[model samples]
Target: MPTPIPPGSANETALLDLLRRHPRVLLTGPPGSGKTTLVHRVATRLADQGQACHCLAADPGLPGFGPPGAICLGRWDPRLDEGGGWRLETIEALATLDSARFRLPLVEAVRRLAARTEAGPLLIDAPGVERGIGGAELLAALVNASHAGAVVRLAPENAPDPYAQERVALGLEVLKLPAAPEARHPGHQLRTQRRTEAWDTYLTEAVEQSLDLVDLAIVGTPPPHDVTAAWHRRQAGLLDATGRTLAMGEVLALEGGRLKLLAPPLGDTPRTLVIRDAMRHSEGHLGTARPYRAPYPATPDEPSLRLPLQEAVDGPRPTLRLDGVRATLVNGVFGDPLLHLRLRHRKRSLLFDLGDPGRLPARLAHQVSDVFISHAHFDHIGGFLWLLRSRIGDYTPCRVYGPPGLAGHLDGLMRGILWDRVEEKAPRFEVFELHDERLAHYRLVAGQPMKALSPREVDDGVLHVEPGFRVRAVTLDHGTPVLAFAFEPDVEVKVRKERLDAHGWAPGPWLGELKQHVHAGVDETVIELPDGSQRTVAELAQHLLLSQPGKRLVYATDFGDTPDNRERLLRLARGAEVLFCEASFREDQAEQARRTGHLTARGCGEIAAAAAVGQLVPFHFSRRHVDDVGELYEEIRRHFPRLAATPGSDPYSEVD
Candidate 1:
């Protein structure tokens, strides 16, 4: 079975064409070869066209091989069996078994699983293709028993392959699938850490399934622990009454008579539950386990590079102010960004995106009265703990406003901290969740626990309204929910310098009083001038005070340049005096930027142009382009010729 000259298209199209010809295809490749990925991709693509496909794991010798809903017939990694992965002694004991006994049951298990997968095409994900010594016989056994129509080996381009020729000699049509560059494995430790997160994410919503002890009469392990618990923990197979695999479940917690299982939706009550310690799943979860990473030159025994606090610091940025707002990047352009903003000669100060807050100048931290969060990405929001911890004794409320789910995320951030034992009061936090329709509010007292406050319905996008300014928020297309803010100052009023010079009063209290009266809009209010003379507020406004539309300083970053979000962002940043946006990538990687929910350099310009902003300040470049942010600015200048030709070279001045 071979795919015909394939129509040029996505990998999905190519895989589907091959699978259409070969009903039972064996995906045989080494560890981290992306064989499991191709199988699931084919199965999912066929499933969309009303063609059902069954994923049969040839064997599960590893803990994270089975994608959710995959049917693994043979025994899995011993670490996950009846004795939990935590019980290393039991797992070590099981790993010492003879190769024959381990290889024998797999044939029977594959035969039994084959009968149930007859309803649709079979996508076989074969495991253990020469990862260790004495692994060849097990691989041979699985290949011979599967009786697949075709075998596809995923490997490097032009790489020497032994299995391709061997499988072809066995009368199997062979295809060479090259590995993707991004698919290069990070390492074993990184993979385990990644799997731990996957497990945590899956088990977060898992419910308890009560297992009657009598159902395990067939396993015959011992009291206190079911032998099947081991296999189920590795990859639990949930089956229907007809013994069809419904989904794959991950055993998270196992107490007496109750099993905490996290599986994909099975729809109805699963009639047969199969766990793998010593048992085999006769039958199915949607996400396959994440693909394995390819090995690099770095030895596994080598000490891993760890990121320490000093490593994250990129030093301070040159002081810059846009429209009286003193803007200083707490972390340099390439570092974890913590933008510090304070109104010159005014009490109001704010921290935007709290990245490496520990490095933030102590002077600035004390003045930060508010924090505006963009999103919860580690690079964006990682230093919030330092911020919260720093402001522990500060009694004044430090309001934190961001998109929805911020309160819960904050709780998770604070979980490791001992709240009860703390003597000092944490900064009083008023957390606000910005939604399109309304703002969900919550409050955390200095020493007390975080609790929800009443919700406030806002007609427009206004999240916080203060005497001097009001903040309007719009949701951005970041991987997580992000809120872009516009700080719209109330009608700006300033004393006319020429008028004061004309009066020759040397700029005293009269100037301040005139501006105050003008701001109040009190026409009849009389302000006593120098030399015992008085002027009406209306007259003072005409001669001395200058009033104009308030400065709208907008903050938007770490978001994708998508159509929907662009429209919302344009509205939020309409006519902004200064617009700070992210240029995480260059236009050349625009597709990748959009995929990652980040913006290209030109993306920032497009946003600035669309919003008709007075000044476009683009920062937050990806570290991959650290040596030359010139490329980012170059593409940005294409769309926004008005933008500075070079990075950090902005000529835009404060709008009067």
Candidate 2:
């Protein structure tokens, strides 16, 4: 189960041995989890071994993963057809998509593709998600219809899969998934630059190239749109006879079957064979449509912007846990505004924010018991649908606590996709909405049309009350209802071993009961010591128990620093051991911060100082400061100097 492919080696001897027996090997993982890369790598190794291998692109956004005639669905470009990429998307598959008979056409398409393939073992490349319900379902169907022999998932056990529980029932051998060591999220802007750089490199230099289209063929399943226009209108890559990308070219004229194109200079024509129509898109192309096959997908012309920030996608990281909790910036510190506070108290797990949690490790997503959303902004809650889909069909209920309209937001998200087939078993959603000094609660099970829930009036401000801790919430001025939460753990009772030994009573399980009774203030409660002697809980605890206040953590972000709001935060965050707050801008951009319902570093420091927090971890900086977030930190540090590490720190460092 260790990685079949070892580190520093692309050697496929082990992989080829497995491929002889397994016909269809499906690869899946989270975004940047390297599922596609693994498929490509494994296919290359198989080809080197003289085994005929074809990789099927189950995810449309990525295609041409194998040699020409490879099976690919979605994103059919007219120019790339000459590469021999087999279009797996059938007309019937597109027509009957999401219908009551959804699986039939897709299953037929898979079978048809398998029938035509004359080459080696097939590798199906599936779209990876930390939690992708639709993708998983689609993968399950493809694997079953294709008669896959094995699945090589590139993620942990909690990775998204529709048939995760039913795998054994389906006779599928689940290979041990391995994390790609080279995987790293380049971030939004950086990823965009990388794509642009590829385009820029392809477009460098200047020349007019003649492309003979008489023998050209397209690589994708032609869309319903006019095929000629689809070719003429798209950006293309000119390929050589050997199928190597020679240069990028913009189509000039396609008259009389002779294609005129402009591209970088080449010494000679080298007999251009095909023009690839598709251009790989980076995540930052805000309104661009990514038409991956789906029950929930924007149209080709529909501009739906989804901004996801990845943490582990970039590389392996040092532990971010602080005081028994993991505090991760959902977005980069200088990137989007998303913070994830993972509280691991005992076996219980709690989450803060629903930002771009697509980057969250699959292993962590499975442990989440509750999520607290600060606001409903796209940058704050963009990862909501992914998180929900990840937990789909989960028997465990995950509670969502948020400001007003939380339930409605979740309802709209669920209704966006076609769930006609899997409505009976969906994740149980328990949403709690915060009103001023009150809370309303609602529960929803997916697959049914959601209705507006009139939250029952709970006058108490407490959002959650656990056995050893309680959570309180308040709305802030964030142009919308933004809630800030505080977790207050109960005081701890330490049994005085010295006093117990002095009393000639040996410590035992009775001390635990005594401590519990002491915390409960049950004076009449009696307990037996090791010697079987009975004593009142109050008397036993009088000498043996010493109480200490438990810790508190406050998470605040995406809010304007109005005086009233500041005063409220000060009261709620008072005496917090840690305060994770947003410092979106610097003092120079104070006006901009206020206009955006955000806060400056100076403002965050002032609020933290007023709250008298032990530590202030500032984040959610503006993109303008992407050059360096250190300046904002320095500005905030001026107010709350680095006294925690300083020698002989002055008492003045302690805020009121």
Candidate 3:
């Protein structure tokens, strides 16, 4: 482990220097590591230099800018206080916090904060759980979403570094500093006392208010369903539409279709009431309340119905999950043709086409590791700049595969942008263009010209291959050569926990060996166990393994309804679990579809039926059908009975 810098005023100068290079910094350490003290010192120094600093208090357990059970955002400006002392004024609670269930929401809140155009540096005070797997995962999620370029770690004397592995994994600049001399671990009693004092201070001007339940939405946890039980108190936060906490209170009563809360006076009616952990106030002191254990009844499933095309296009978006991938249409059917596919358990994603990605969230855009371009139309590639902007600080290179001339198009697009201040940390792109059984490669990075690499020959139309899946591409004429892609996964072998438990065997690394043997068809091979024992691979496979076939998804769009195009599409899409095909015109307007190099509703349905696909999802509809798009769905339903009613609906479940 590297030795940390000694504690002194020089450390403050080093931190300020780091802040100059990286505007956003995350301060993380274990309990009693003086992370909060360091945050104060940094804020004071910045304020002394006439710079404002934004601070995010993320540890719900420890009271900082906000009370316990809440994540707060606050700022320290030099002009706010006349004395020029360090003070975090204008604090707002961003979200009601829970350790296990609210991690993702917290990360999202951080992302939104980082995207804002604030005038000062942002310092995040992370929780003190830097030693376990859960802590590591939480830290990683926060760092990724916070857009933080550096992390400052504070450790006690002679303590092992808890963030060493994660620093290297995330490629973040880290500065290690020693803990403060006065830092000491607080006991359980002291922690509870501090929480009580915080609550008292926060609720000094308390008042009672009765609110109608019908006008407010309940977030976080819902009240118990049984109305007859004795009314119990639960800590709650009132928030507006923007997620700013209006007030914190305790639910005193829930009856007569109304809620009574004891809290500070509210300026206006809150939009939401976020119920947190059970708590109560007794004789001016806060304490834990009894837990509610009665299970709420399950919500009944809604019946599926075929909605009109206009309603479907304007309705809420849906996410469909196949065996190993989750798919979403970027802009529904009426806008552009972009399909987002995220591999389950892979922490990575692929974009079927580079259509306008402005609707995609920042986190999702950052996860895109590869992109497949059907053609380089303006609508198909207009949002490439947005994608690039979202991944400015990410180190992973995004690989793009497309038809011929794609490298040249990307080179021209990249050359238009000025990279004068772009650093080496900017995102990179690896472009692969397929032309006549050969794949040409081009590398793109900010502040550098595109570099061409040697071309590689590909057979069987396999353009890209990974360990668990492969992507195959084929060209179809759509006025221009357009690419269609098929994503096929290898066979899956899963462990049967019931069988292993029945044999009184514990799961370990041997399961991976068993899977490898089964996947490689080496069932007769012997497997070694961790306990210095040996077992036959065949016996383990018979007792504990279940083999299943993998699913395939196909994406074909923007191709005319010609015989040649139909044949190529069917050859690539046959037996696919889900086929996302284009239906840009009505059945009677086949001539218009052909003229525009698109497919009609009837043509899409016929192709899906002929290819024997399990489900057909028709998208990229013409705007003219906004009023009477039902006819298009009816036409497709006449030919393909397994057509999805709406893009939001799950097409895979219909086949099952």
Candidate 4:
């Protein structure tokens, strides 16, 4: 049963009908227009009818609207209790909002509620009076929710409510839905001036005086007209140039190269149109329109290259994998202080580092996803300038990650170099400055810096838990704080291949799936063998069959041998078939290594021996020891005895 619809005014019933049809609703009006009270009444009605309805207030400081059928969730209670019930909350807890700074958290909350409800209805009450903050935010919230599988609803009455007609119009525009001719505002009236001739003369003089470039600089330029056509022409010219060098689906410089486009929507072709820059750029004009078009490139190639998103609204987080090799090698040295990891799984092999990449080693230039940097050290990041300007990789966005300085660093880099290139080459670099405490589970998307990831933080950790494995990071002694990571698969193998085959079970990809299903506690997992045989997981277990522990890999570098550091390394590297350590120095250069607080080949070997690791492979060698790399390897082997002597190859080579 559902609670009766809240009725007092005719508009209330109409709005309730809209809410019934559309689960996601953004109700906006002037202060005291009853947006909050209306939302609460509707929620109460839904609850009375046995439906799961939650009305979350956009403000944290606001008092609770009532009790248990609806619980108030604030910073104090972020997680919705594991029960079929409604929970009220501030927008921050419900979403990833930074109200004071005007950052909205709609996507994160929408994703969580979507997962919990199986497409149940959710109503968000936005702060209606803070128009500057609330107007754009409410608009964005509606847009994002619609994109994420929620049906959106709105009230467009204009007599008693404010901005209602405009809000409805904007929603239709954003959703690309057909617009309904709205009723006119009942009491709206135009102000008339008594001295019309005098006003006309004053306006004529103002228009004439504002046309000069110098005056425009001092007083700011006017909106779209014959005078601003030149600016549009120049912009179109640059976008044409950009299309020549870059491909479709790639990011580009826009708004004087300060913004990064994630991926252009389908069917739009590249052509420039002069228009007002969004919030990031200064307002171009008030009460005026400007020419705008989808200047972004839209080619057939773009659609084929776009990464497939998972069905779940919370986009898939794909880690770098080598495809054939369990480990992908990080290479390259010319760029900034960033290390490079070349992924071997996809058509494009990506380079992860920050540095000047001049004519990307032929192998990397044609690849689709390249240049994801780790941090912002100039030595690591300087090469990005050349890469961005070169128009290589079809101008595909090169994603970057680092601490707080990333966004500013990228902005400065672009502004210092080629800001106007936005019209020519779409800005291809996207930066994210990680702030963990402020946004527990929100990671700014590659292109959409404004939206944060929806995953909730389970612990004080950056890596989220996956279905089969967990990723963990530890601080390394890099003089500067740096982290090393490891991935541990949770599945354990209990039966040997020979034993399974002896029991007439055939081996195939499906067998692996069957094992996973069984390990996940699926009781009736039936495996079909290669010879058309079938068997239950219970039967296999009855025969003492099970899974073995999965593989373990650890990466550690830029650390010295402090007792705790050594112990951490030992535990992480213990039994690892392959261990990669920083061999910045040789045994003879131990003094230099100690002074620099980096590991020598001998020191790495010592640590490997102490940890009882199976193999020690040293890297991060100093340029001074380039010629003596072999000798250094031999010296390290003398101490560890298990150092593998396999000749290392340039992992970034495309030929392999």
Best by TM-score: 3
For residues 9-50, write the lDDT of model 3, one tens digit per residue.
Answer: 566777789999999888888876777777777888887877
Global lDDT of model 1:
0.59
> Which candidate's lDDT is highest?
3
Per-model RMSD to reference:
29.5, 18.4, 14.2, 23.8
Off by over 4 Å in 3: 1-318, 493-545, 645-656
- Local error of candidate 1 at 170, Å? 94
The lDDT for every candidate, in the order shown, is: 0.59, 0.57, 0.72, 0.42
Worst 10 residues of 2 by lDDT: 646-655
| Candidate number that wins on TM-score, 1 or 4 | 1
* Candidate 4: residue 655 lDDT (0-100): 22
Cα deviation of 230, candidate 3, in Å: 28
Segments of candidate 1 deviating more than 4 angstroms: 1-324, 419-424, 502-543, 644-656
Clashing pairs in 3: none
Instruction: Summarize candidate 2's per-residue lDDT along 1-656 as a digit string, tens digits.
Output: 67564651432344455677787676655556666556556655554555556655643222333211113432222234452233333211121112112334445555666555554587766544333355556656767766788876565345455456645555777765655555533333333344345344435665777766655543333222222433342345444565434444555556666666666665444344333223332332211111222121112432221122112222111124443354555544544454555543233467777666654554455567888888778777777777777666545878889998888888888778777666555767788888876677787777775544566655446788765568888788888878888877676666676887787875444555566566556789878665557889877767678778867878888899899789878888988887878888999998998899999989988888887888776767676764444566678887875212111111111011
Worst 10 residues of 1 by lDDT: 88-97
Backbone clashes in model 2? 8
Model 3 per-residue lDDT at 268 = 70
